[model samples]
Target: MLLADPNNPTGTAVDLDALEQFAQALSPECLLILDQAYCDFADGERAGRGLGLAQRLPNVVVLRTFSKAYALAGMRIGWCAADPEILASLEAVALPFTLTALAQAAALAALDQEAALFAQVQTTVAQRRRVRQELLAMNFEVPPSEANFLWLPLGAGRLVSPSGARGPGSACAA
Candidate 1:
């Protein structure tokens, strides 16, 4: 099973306890792949728990990307945490030197600036909440979000103007 925590587009997340319970319920043969690209924005227990989950569950692999919170989208740098055996198995079939020198250096630098990284994440979370509130005030039905982006699930053939006016026909040009 593949899951994106603090899910992209919608920005909803499952709590740690719920995640553990769900993992426990899964079959032994099931491999749970957790994509935590935007997990830095998650609050309380849901934040920074991917490595712990990977450590506790043999069938779980936690994937992380530097693209989102680290502001390294152009680098295309990513990583995964899993059981040693699982990692070894993956390494056996993986190509070598996938990371470039510049990207590697940038990733190391990003890790070194954890304080700034987290501060940016907090700012983003605040801005996200503000944007959600503004959209709600304008009568846009925005679901609660935990990521950097917001999801506007527009109803079929309904367009809402900034002044809370709803019009018929699809507002999307495409």
Candidate 2:
């Protein structure tokens, strides 16, 4: 099974204890793919736990991307953590030259400037809170976000487009 923690769109993170239970329940034959693309934005306890779990569980694979926090989307660099044999299996099918030389340098440089990079993440988090509050004040229902984005679920009869067109049902189906 594959899951994105601090999930995309909604930005909700599963509790660590619950995740552990889920991992423990999975059969050895079952591969659990945990995507930690937004893990850097999550709080301390939640971040890197999947990697730790992957280190311990042969069936677990934790994937993370440098796109978001490292500001390296253009580089298209990503990485994964899993048992050595699992990684070897993945490496067997790997594409050639997928990671550019410049991307590696940038990612390394970003690592060197961790404090500055994380400060930017914190700024984004603060802005997210402020925007969520403003949206809530305007009567839009905004879910609490741990990721960089916010998810707003419009209710019935409350969906309106920027052009003032009314949306149908409980969603703004354009």
Model 1 lDDT vs. the true structure? 0.88
Query: Model 1, 56-109: lDDT tens per residue?
Result: 889899999999999999998989999888899999999898889999899999
C-alpha TM-scores of all predictions: 0.86, 0.84
Worst 10 residues of 1 by lDDT: 165-174
lDDT of 2 by residue, 1-174 (tens): 999998997898998989988998999989999988988877668877898889788999999999999888999888898999988988999888888799999888888998898799889888888999999999898888778889888644546766677646434555
* Candidate 2 regions with alpha-carbon error over 4 angstroms: 155-174
Best by lDDT: 1
CA-RMSD of model 2: 4.5
Worst 10 residues of 2 by lDDT: 165-174
Off by over 4 Å in 1: 156-174
Residue-pair clashes, model 2: 0
**lDDT for model 2:** 0.86
